[model samples]
Target: MAGYVVAAILLFSAVAYFVGRAAGERFVSANGDQVHSLPGYHGAFVAVWVGIPALILVLVWLSAQGSVIDGLVLGGLPADLVAGKTPSEINLLLSEIKNVAAGHIFSEPTPEIVAASQALLRWDEIARWAMVVVVLAMLIGTMFVARLRLAPRFRARTEVERVLSWLMIACAVSAILATLGIIVSLLAESFAFFRMVPLHEFLFGLRWEPQIAIRADQVAGQGAFGAVPVFVGTLVISCIAMAVAVPVGLYTAIYLVEYADERVRNIVKPLLEILAGVPTVVYGFFAVLTVAPAIRQAGSLMGLAISPNSALAAGLVMGVMIIPFISSLADDALRAVPRSMRDGSLAMGATRAETMLKVLLPAALPGIMGGILLALSRAIGETMIVVMAAGLIATLTINPIDSVTTVTVQIVTLLIGDTEFDSPKTLAAFALGLMLFLVTLALNVIALTIVRKYREQYE
Candidate 1:
């Protein structure tokens, strides 16, 4: 019903725009040279009035209806059944009622639940009908007022521009508020985690266990939250990935830009970028099922031990996954170098290789470095490839052939199943997440600093 109302409102708004424009044109012709804005501006003014207010009201109604219905349904429940339950318990009961109301289950519901579901469905229908009526009335009334206000000398364009400026400001403010909300949430949960485990221990201690027994009598040992080992593993894998991606991707970009024929370059560049669109899970599978086993076999032949799941396997596959990102960005940066730079280098009697190495490459260094930093961030944040190819045993090691886990993997493992939300085990995920955010932020800052410094020099 709500969807139908929206569709009707849209259709009405479109009709209003054409009618409003015709009215403006007629008014302008009757009082020539008196009109200040174009006919199209009057049309847009009417369309905005017809759509924005109605849409805002519809959104407000939808947001409020759920809580209003929930309160009504829960308020009428039997006093005896609701007497001793906590808020969480009440919420769980409501979820079950909702599920039953939606016909998600085949089993019979209790009498109280059945009553509540019926009440909820009735209220939902009433709300939907009320919303439809209110929205349509608003669309009609606003459009009527806007059409009446359209005059020969009305400043329709100015009014329309003012509304658009406010909309832009609102969108900007919403994004800033969203970012602040995320930071506040992370800080609040991280503080709770730190109360259970000291900040210093989490930051500097070498071990990385995060399991905490839910009950005192549970057999599990108390978990350590040292994060250094996880950090080390992340660094090792990321370094290995960068080692494979940077030189290879950059060279590929150079070949496509400076050496390959136009036909060959066109064919090759898209194929290279196809790597970026391949899902990360596919890379994970390739790492686990294909790359890891091959590495193990090769290592065995060389009289070296390699884990079935190793950092090297994850890093190599991740590097392959990141190649497209680096190559595309580097190609753009390389292409941005002026053709005159190459021509001048050739005029100086420099060979093509020397010109590329000493002139074009240097000129494009900032962009190439930017691409590399971006790829490094990609490698650091990657989860699936590491989860499948690198085993989840956090060990403080630089050996790429050893099994290790990253911060993302640990955060995921800690929060996987049903667990106490406020417990340190769960809060630890927030702590790790905050650290990852900070690390990525630092990388971005560093990249910007380098780019700005070199950009100024080159310019």
Candidate 2:
């Protein structure tokens, strides 16, 4: 059924594209003086029109089909079976019944329940195919009608151009909308988690130990969810990443934008990015193999209990990963600062360093800050380096010598392997993600806000 729907949609879309293109050609020929846009616009516009409605129909039908089918199936069951059950209870029962009907080993089913389930399942499948056919027919009909008056003076060019422009706008909007949807979904799950674990406790708790067992019948320890320790680990690692990224990145930016010859810039820029191109997993292993042991041995001399997977190991590797991002962005931002500013400062008898630091860097501060904010955000959101290199123990201590976990690391640990979706351990990840998103979002917002407010506007 999915195959049939896919084929029908694709076939109709191609037909629509050809029809629209033909219409556009005729319109351009009939009224060349009347046309205000290119010939291709008519065809592309018609193709978009033909595809959008049917595509939306397919998406909508697919999304709701399963739930609607399940509801109707559950509704058809005998009154006595469903009378005492609330809707949620009925949903659970119906789900089990469907599994039983499918001959799944998870549940048992009687003959009568099986018969009703099969009937509803068949009806649902039929309805889906029926909807697909109807949409396909509508698309073909629209295309045929659009192709009818393809004369030169038909205004097809203008119409097609307008539609194409709006289609591009809609595509852009779709990406933005998807991001918003993801944020909302994460926020909702986090809200559910906060209800189970107090917000303050989760925020300030020094230890994190997520528990499993979704139902009351199963028992597990009441674990701590305080994220303060994990948050500290993230802060520590991000600070280290920035520490490495800033000096190297800014200097690279300085050389690239202000001093480097074109040939040198071309050769050096990609080589520097090759460092960024190294897979983070490789960096993780490098940290564990090379950095962690060294740190642990160094700590032993200082009378500290340094774990092999110390924060410094992970942080240093993460910093290496971020340096390219910082340099690339900072270089662009610095270069974007007007050359006129540099000229003015140099004309006033300033040395190269003075001109750069006082004039160019200041004017470019907003852009540079924006780049730092970008690198900072990347550092915080990083998962693999911390997961593989930073040990997954939540501790309140600030010592970089000790092992620590991050929000991302805990999220990975909490959700890794097999998981029961409703378990606190799994939900704990959503809570951590929520915290991470909010922090990153806040940092980005503040960075942009400050840059905008403090942006240089020299007379």
Clashing pairs in 1: none
| Residue 83 in candidate 1, Cα distance off native in Å | 4.6
**Sliding window of 10 residues with minimal summed lDDT for model 2:** 149-158
Please give, for residues 13-69, the per-residue lDDT of candidate 1 as tens digits: 898899789988997889888889889889989998898788788878888989998
lDDT of model 1, residue 424: 85
Best by TM-score: 1
* Candidate 2 residue-wise lDDT, 343-376, digit = tens: 8888999999898888888877777888888889
Note the Cα lDDT for every prediction shown: 0.91, 0.80
What TM-score, to 2 decimals, does candidate 2 have? 0.85
Cα error, candidate 1, residue 389 (Å): 2.0
Compare the candidates by lDDT and give the number of the best one: 1
Stretches of candidate 2 above 4 Å error? Answer: 1-11, 27-38, 76-83, 97-128, 164-192, 212-219, 275-279, 297-305, 415-428, 456-459
